[model samples]
Target: MSNVILMIFTGLSVGAVYFLLGSGLALIFGLMRVLTFAHGAYLTACAYAGWFILRHSSLAAGPSIGTLLLALLVGVVVGGALAFLTERVLLRALYQRDHLDQLLVTAGLGFSLVALLNGIWGPDSRAVPTPPWFTRTTTDIFGAHIARGDFVLIGVAVLLLIALEAFLKHTRHGLVVRAGVENREMVRALGIDVRRSFTLIFTVGGAVAGLGGVLAALYANAVNTTIGDTYLLYAFIVLVVGGLGSLRGAAIAALAVGLLQQFANFYVNPGLGEILSFILMGAMLLLRPEGVGGKKIRLI
Candidate 1:
């Protein structure tokens, strides 16, 4: 029973990160109709940025709370800036192009980002150690040992999810974004600045990805050039399983995936965990191509 509880907590933490990352991808796809292959690159870049800050800054060995906060902030700023630049310079040119063209452009951008990361960070595995407080702290509940880091991650995820829901449902900017998603031409016809809304959504999406990256780095205690690739497939799986353009779907899908993966890892081989996740996703796709909570989409 204690083991089950521990697994549940751990799964929730991981699920939260997946939710954020998958949500960003889904939002971009729904709003822009562009499949961004560069999203994984952005996530990798954020991870590296967090690793760099932790290695070189004075906060590397301080209280875990402060260090984690600082790293998350840095990740958000850097990721958001990168997204803004990419949209303005590259994505803007492909906005009116066909899906094939957009895919090719984004794929090229992703390759270029990989090359750039290699040049800067080299091909080495780097670890982001948990701070002193986190390393030493543990709580016993129902005869199970729970790390403080897990609690912190779950808390942050809950807060961010609520905030994102409120932003989309209650804010004017969010309404414009939703409008653009539904009918870009109609939004423009109504004298709204659709471009600005796109930019805002892109930035926000990037920030969310960055936050996920930071949490991943802290939890795994390692950052490498291929870290993005590791999570990219999983993020896409979550997006597909959750439904496109639906935050609620993404959240629910993430939790389901996380818990499923965690229990599979515990009862089965860890190496096969990803394979199992893929299998689950594939089954969902075959049975409900529209996703668990998405409207039916026609494929060309």
Candidate 2:
């Protein structure tokens, strides 16, 4: 019983990480109508940027909250700036072109950037520095030994989720974003320069990816070149199951997949969780193409 509880909590934290990655993908795909293959590169780069700050800066002597916050800030800024540039330069050229062309270009960018990261950072994982108070220590919870870090990740995810929901449902900018997702043509026809929204959307998406990258490193206790790649695939599955424009769906799908994978891996086999997740994605594609939320971002 304790084991089950532990797994659930662990799964929630894992799911929190997934949500961080997926939510960004969702927002980008939701508004831009472009599958952001370059997003993985954004994550990987920002993560490395943050890691470099922490591992090499003055704060490297010891764990400090300043180190943590600075790394996160750098990641977010770099991510957002990279995304803004990509949208203004690379993406704009392919706007009128075929989506396959867009995909190919972005995928190439993603691959090339990752390769650069490998060359620069080397193909190995580096331990992430945490605060002195921070450790992968386990605490008792209802007879379950839960990692303290799990609570941190889960709490952060939850807070971000609330902030996002409020932003989308209340803010004027967010309303434009939702409207753009629902009907880009209509939004444009209404005399709103949706192009501005496009850049904002991309920036927001990239910022989310950046935040996820930092948090992911902290969660895993390390940073690696391929860390974002592993999560990007799962995040795509999340988009498929949750729908392209639904944060609510992304959250639910993330948690479900996280829990399912953890439980299956523990009880059944080590890698079966990933296999099962893919299977679930296939099932969802065939049975509910509109997604679990029954929301479809019209392709037009």
Candidate 3:
């Protein structure tokens, strides 16, 4: 029983990061209607940024909670900046083009970004330095041993999810975003400055991805140039299962996928775990067609 609990907790811990990444992708797709291939790049870059800062800076001696927080701040800022640049310089040019053009451009850009990362960080994997506090802390529950950091990761994800839901449902800016997702033309008709909203949403999405990168890196005790690619693939699966625009669905699907993957990996072949995830996704598509929380809408 304790082993089962541990496996479930492990699944939830990993799923929280996927939820963060998938929710960002869903937001960008739902609102901007553009498939951002560069998102994974953003995540990788931020992880690298955090890794670099923590390793090279004064914090390298013995990182504390404050040091980790600073690294996180750096990661998020870099992610947002990169997203801003991508939006202003690259994505803006394709707003009027069809989805195919946008996808091609972003895909090309993603490959280029990956190459850039390889060139800069090299092909070797790097580890994120966890603060001593995180490593030293542990708790026991029902005969199961758990790391405080794992719980921290789960807590952060849950809080962020709740805050985002509140923001979208309660705040004026979030309401505008939700409305824009539904009808960009209608929002523009109301003089809501839809373009600015687009920029904001895209930047926020990037920031969320960056946060995920940092958290995942800490959990894995490593980062690599290909980290983004791995997570990006999983993010798409989560988005597909959750529905394109539904944050709630992303959260639930992320947990489901994480649990499924972990359980399969433990009881079956590691390769089979990923295969099971895909099978689940295929079944969901055949049954729901529109996704778990997705509404039928014409993709423009």
Candidate 4:
């Protein structure tokens, strides 16, 4: 039972990362109708950025809450900037194009971004030591050792989820974005700048992805050139399994995937464990094309 509880915590932590990454991808795809292959690239960039800050700055592993907060803030800003540029330079042009063209263009952009990241950060693995405050000690929970970092990640995920929900439900800017999603033509007719809403959505998505990167870098204790690649597929799977544009769906789907993956890894071979995630995703796709959550438009 203790082991099971431990696994659940671990799964939740991993799911938090997936939720963060997938939420962003889903938002971009849902609002802009652009399949952004560059999402992973943004995550990779953020990981590298966080790594650089931790290595060079006065930040030390463990309980440096202030430093972690600053790192996350930097991630949001940098990620937002990157998203804005990508939208302006690439996605904006492909908005009216066919899905195939958008796919190819975004795929190419992703490749370009990957190459750019490699050029700047090299292919070597870089360590991202946890803050001194976060690394203090592990707590025994039902005989399972839980790290403070894991709890922190889960807490952050919950807080972010709540915050996003509130923003989307109550905020004026969020209402505009939702309105645009439902009826771009109507939004434009109302003299609301739909494009601006798209840009905001993209920027917010990027920031979420960056937060995932930060959590991943700290959790893994290392960041590498291909780290983003590792989670990209999982993010897509989560997005698909969850309904597009549905934040609640994404969160629930992420938790399911995380727990499923953990169970597979524990009971099955690691290679097979990875395969199980796809199998489950495939089943979900076949049985329910709309995803686990039914699709509903908040706007007209």
> Which residue runs does candidate 4 get wrong by more than 4 Å?
58-63, 296-300
Q: lDDT (CA) for every model shown?
A: 0.80, 0.84, 0.82, 0.81
In the range 1-300, model 2's lDDT, one tens digit per residue, is 988998998889888988888988888886568877988888899889888887776453775778888988999999899889888988977776777888888898889989999998799999887765545566677798676778878887888788878977898778887787668899999999777877887888888889889888877879889998999999988888898778889999899899999999999999999999999999988888778767764555
- For residues 170-259, could you state the per-residue lDDT of candidate 4 as single tens digits? 987789988887788998898888888788889989999888888899888899878887888899888888877777888898898898
TM-score (C-alpha, index-matched) for candidate 1: 0.93
Instruction: Give one clash count per candidate, in the order shown.
Output: 0, 0, 0, 12
lDDT of 4 at 188: 89
**What's the CA error at residue 293 for candidate 3, in Å?**
1.6
Error of 3 at 237 (Å): 0.6
lDDT of 1 at 51: 80
Taking every candidate in turn, the Cα RMSD to the unseen true structure, in Å, is 1.9, 1.9, 1.8, 2.8
| Decoy 3 TM-score against native | 0.94
Candidates 2 and 3: which is better by lDDT? 2
Worst 10 residues of 2 by lDDT: 130-139
Q: Residues 118-144, candidate 1: write the lDDT tens digits.
A: 998788888786676654548688888
Candidate 1 Cα misplacement greater than 4 A, ranges: 58-64, 297-299
